[model samples]
Target: MPKFAANLSLMYNEYEFLDRFAAAARDGFTAVEFLFPYGFIAGEIKARLRDSELTQVLFNCPPGDWAAGERGIASLPGREEEFKRSIERALGYAQVLGNTRLHVMAGLLQYGQDRGRHLEVYLHNLAYAAQQAAAHGVTVLIEPINTRDMPGYLLNTQEEAHAICREVGAPNLKVQFDLYHCQIVEGDVAMTMRRDIAGIGHMQIAGVPERNEPDTGELHYPYLFGLMDELGYDGWVGCEYRPKAGTSEGLGWFRKVMSNKY
Candidate 1:
């Protein structure tokens, strides 16, 4: 069975950020992931993970100014320095937290912007990140987000992400196959998984349309979980979704799955 990582950024919002670690562990999550760790000191979060005995699976590099609506700055022009600085900061946290995977978000495209230039910058920046992260035994991941939820997002499909990975020519760089985004941009999530399994470093899932619990969505997650086992994918599958009701109440599917696993 695929190991599931509770996404604290979206789930368990009832508790404060630091307190969510224990909450997730109490609910049977052996591992956890979140959007960003910059808000708190690395040692503080590390202590929580240690206390909870939960593994830190993944987190993103800073995405420029998140509050100002910047998703990421790797693909944006004139922000290369800021992007590099973000990577350095993230690596410091990863070292302290014992995290090995880092998701690098590709920023949105502006109207009338040069697509080719953005691609160039993206490739260049990702290559740098891969080189730097490799020294720490970390793998840098790039995810193809759906344009519907994140309008103008630079990357949008699995093919595009894998192609970028190939062009970057860095072995440490891989794709974060977010099934939610894949379903929105293109159906055939299973087929895509099979085709790109080799390059996938991590996976994420959420319900389509509503982006709620997987059991509440059109996609049958049970089958997907089985498929991951059949394909020999041993990476953590991030539960990156919003809870329809309370976070704990919405975990019926997860609890059932865990019950069956043991």
Candidate 2:
């Protein structure tokens, strides 16, 4: 089975932000990821991870004005400087945390007419982020979020993500394939995942539609986990789902998957 990491931002919410690291550790999760860590300094987060002996697998670049509803600034035209700064700040944090993977969120698309401009900006910003991250031996990731969940999210398909990665042509640039979002937007999750596995840097999973525990969903996560093992996926598979019950209670799925081959 693939290595599993709890999403501290979405999982174990009962604990405070800084406390989630230890909570995940107590639940037998050796790796963890979150959206952003701006609230706490890198040194503080590093201490938490060190104390828990948990690996910080992945985290995202800062999204612009998160409190003001900005998902990202990457795809927003005329924000080149802001996007580059985000990448720099992310690298600094990743270095302190000893984490190499960073997800770069594509900004929201305002209207159909402005999409072309946004794509141009997105590609340019992605290329720069990839270049800078590569210098530090860090990999930059981009994910395709489902429009249903994030209506205006700029990136929405594997094809688009793959194409952008190609155009960027940076060895460090790769896709952050989130199974929940992919299943929501495109149903050929199995084939798409396998076909794009090489270019996929990191992967996340959650139950479809409800985005809850993987044990009860339209997807047969067992099959997917088996497929990942068959494919020799050595990267971390992040558990980025909401707990329909308590966080630890829903982890029966992970236990079941790890105990069996499928």
**Top candidate when judged by TM-score against the true structure:** 1
Give the per-residue lDDT of model 1 (tens digit) for 37-121: 9999999999999999999999999998899999999999899999899999999999999989999999999889999999999
For model 2, state the Cα shift of residue 170 in Å: 0.5
Q: Where does model 1 exceed 4 Å of error?
A: none
Give lDDT tens digits, candidate 2, residues 1-262.
6899999999999999999999999888899999998788999999999999999999999999888889999989778898888888999999999999999989788766588888898988988898888889999999999999888999999999999999989999999999999999999999998899999999999998899998778998888988998888999999999999799888888877767744
Q: Over 4 Å off in model 2, which ranges?
A: none
Candidate 2, residue 257: Cα displacement in angstroms equals 2.4
Clashing pairs in 1: none
RMSD of each: 1.1, 1.1
Most accurate candidate by lDDT: 1
